[model samples]
Target: MTTLLPSLPPQSTLLTQASQVLMHNYSPAPLVLTHGNACTVWDAAGNAYLDFTAGIAVNTLGHAHPAIIEAINTQAQQLMHVSNLYATQPCIELATQLTQLGRFSKALFCNSGAEANEAAIKLARKWAKQHKHPHATQILVFGNAFHGRTLGALSLTPKEAYQVPFAPLMPSVKVGVFNQTENLDTLITNHTAMVMVEPIQGEGGVNVATPEFLQALRRRCDETKTVLWFDEIQCGMGRTGTLFAFEQVEGVLPDGVSLAKGLGGGFPIGAILVNEKLADTFQPGDHGTTFGGNPLACAVGLAVLNELTQPAFMATVRDCGSLLHEGLGQLQVDFPQLVVDVRGWGLMQGLALAEDQLAVGDLVTHARNAGLLLVGAGGNTVRLIPPLVVTPTEIHHALGLLRSILGGV
Candidate 1:
């Protein structure tokens, strides 16, 4: 264990002040985080914790990377905000770069994953009405898939726990079994407009879609002339040790892709990549956003893409990810009773507990107290999403902390 840091001022006053103003939608930890460096962040009380969550996979290059900070600073000085009515050079440049990488002809920018996905949904719906069967309005999504929080996205997310509060969402959403090839055939009827899936379901417990299953879905979508969409919001942008998570599964490509989370490396930015098939789906005034393609966000996104997609950087990620995986595998062997499975691709891995009685939340709480931070996913899974910039040494350190926690338990 590391040396205990000095205690700072109480955060009760801070929480009390925030409760008066901020909405009660989120249940944030009591600690007031002040600043972060690399994969470690210090709370207001001067205690540092190894950040495995990586802002839920938003900080691709880790917190406050010099490149991201410099890009934000430079763009802020030049031009910060501009309406979408006026074209910005930074946005155009970023779009061109993203198109080049994603094999898409066009791109649309947005502020968050939800907006990006919403754009995809709208584009798919438009295509269905105009191109496919007019009655084809059904959006097919998989069970345990989390697209986003918007009503359209929520309609596809079939989790009753999240959906009950906001009942009566978008119509004709067909929910199927994720990674189960047999179940998808029934769901993809003639009325199916779009089939949206995550290459790897991040919030749904790091469940990776089998390559065969994806290929089958691809074939079906092609046969039905339905738009295939991949929600790479959490699993894309080098999280899966590749440019896109779908790249890992060969012979399977989505007509549309929703990207966000790690795209801007901490800066809020999202985008949809559309292939030639759906490139012309959205005409002017079809769909838009006020702060979608702002210069500052695009500048940061460009910087993040440049750093993350480099040959050396990606090679390093592969090596570090291997190390982390090996360590986790060893941990699974060491504590088989506790760990049910360690499954995921690249840095987006998870440790699913053996039973509900284990309580993944309690493990996360204990890990946080031990100076290592983690987040829980569905299926009683503990997610380990350290920044892609994580080194081999850092990986070992994290494993040590995790082993210590497990040993104590």
Candidate 2:
């Protein structure tokens, strides 16, 4: 790959300008990233780092993938943004691909995971009003679940810190303990409009929902005529060695599924896939977005799906995931005092650190300083979400870096 470093202001000057202009919502790292290729990114100061974060598991093919870049450039030149009233080929084709892959009857495109989840909430309310009682509007979500940061999705997320600051969130929302199948009957009732959950909770410490628990939720939702939706924004699009995390569970098909993150590689796109039962819940004008299904985003999304759905892509994901998991497990064995647990499936793994021994943020910072990037999740866990196309050599190199960090600690 050719490297053409663009002329720019000093890193310190840029950081100061960003602090003055941008909001203080995020306390970002000091590095000013310039460009990337494969699994590595170069900062403005010409410092290269292995990107294990993969933009929080959004970069399906890593940086500067040929397919994604071609799609973006080609679609931008031909057609970019048009109103939702006008249909585009890329939008229609992308929807067809998603419905076919997910075995869902229909799809609604949006610009982000939060919007997809918000659409699901609206669809559930409308469906309940028409089918169930008028007051059947309660939504049931599990604890430690992160749907999104928007108001509707935030209400579903039970984290006190993220919720308390934005008080008086959406009403008619109920919380349940994740994987607690014993309380399904009490949690999901006739008045429940929808039951949304993450098959593998990403932000909530990479928690995996058991197959039995999902089976119970499916049965109860059927009995009460409630919609069971899976928020696959973080775990979908080959992140979990499958197209969707729910596929690994037996007889656990959801009524609806929300998707984003890796769907468009790095381009922003989200969608809501619904089964035949709830396919007709949303009418033509029920809900929409201005730039949801724009040609450029859909084109890039199609390119990403094309690459992910290749014959050997998923098998490679499984193999790489096993390798990564093995490395993490070895770390647990080597550093029993610091690494308390290693959990998660496929490439979306997490290393839970002992709070008494070390802080997750400290470990992440140490890794970053040592030319590796990592992200911290809930429960004092450090997420290792690398690109799906990462090679064995890269995985080993990352493990070596992590081992060095742990040894120093």
Candidate 3:
């Protein structure tokens, strides 16, 4: 048997040592980053990389923004985490801000996308049962969708590799084609609990649902009692140059929205906002969390909300997003063989490769060597979700790096 190791090892030696100590859950890249500044991170080796992944779209304001640091420091000095029984100003204010933007009646706080989704699933089933559609426990999800890794979310995930080993997933989940409205009609019936969708699917190769499709779903959900839930954990929080990607479409609002990632601006937080009619579905004893909605996380979440809601800030995202999209569009013209398609809304962008997934890896690794970090998804696509605060200069540089790599490929 391998000998046990200590936990206080140096950062340089941590990965190797931790591999033996910790559970093998994830296959992280071989870089041990020690610290970071806005839109950039430095490994223990002092190698710098422009962060295009943005902590998988978690660091919305980028690493260590001055305002974020100040908020966290001040909040920590005063209060970190108090029990949820005591209401904090930050928590109250954030709820107010979120509710103001939409028709959501109440916000239930949690600590991750998976947990928020779990809460949503439970709430949906309970609501359906109470409404007398007891058999309406089936949830309709899309192919190539990812909600989280928890059992409920994993059960909804379409990826086989993440689910086959963890068999015996929660039952009654039906899979449908994303952006295919006709298929949704066939799958969703009176027995369907809820129809969960991602406005701009982040992990599913950044596929943005057509406006017609979302409108169709919204109409159908309204007619039927099936709750319309949007898993905006990755595509929401101003990533699409708006508070939520659904806003991009006219007359399409979800009954509940599952949020995380950018909402806390790096601090771990998740929430599910339910409309007025469905808000009371859960009774007091129905659900609770020990660490969810703690003061520290709420404080950071408020800070992120405040900064992201600024009109000027959102305008910059729109401008920068357009520039990046146009730049990538131009690049696609020259390397048609390398780029099968380019899609995504705002900062949640992706490049579909003409070749196989292996070639996408080669291109991504080459990008890393050129001082840019990227993440890939299913369907041979590489995501380019840079920090929302990324400057045009950085975008141009990143594009140049991609050009060099694509030219070679």
Best by lDDT: 2
Candidate with top TM-score is 2
Judging by TM-score, tell me the better candidate of 2 and 3.
2
Instruction: For candidate 2, list the clashing residue pairs, or say none.
Output: none
Q: What value of lDDT does candidate 3 attain over all alpha carbons?
A: 0.87
Better TM-score candidate (1, 2):
2
Candidate 2, which ten residues in sequence have the lowest lDDT sum? 1-10
In TM-score terms, candidate 2 sits at 0.98
Model 2 Cα lDDT, one tens digit per residue, 1-409: 3343768787788899999999999989998888999899988777899999999999999999999999988999999999798999999999999999989999889999999999999999999878987988999999899999999989998999999999899999999999999988998887899999999999999999999999999999999999999999999999999999999999999999999999988899999999998899888788889998999999999999999999999999999999999999999999999999999999999999999999999999999999999999999999999999999999999999999999998
lDDT of 2: 0.93
lDDT of each: 0.89, 0.93, 0.87
Candidate 2: RMSD to truth = 1.1
lDDT (Cα, tens digit) per residue for candidate 3, span 197-231: 99888888889889998899988877778889999
TM-score of each: 0.97, 0.98, 0.95
* lDDT for position 364 in model 2: 93
Task: Choose 1 or 3, whichever is better by TM-score.
Answer: 1
Per-candidate clash tally:
0, 0, 0
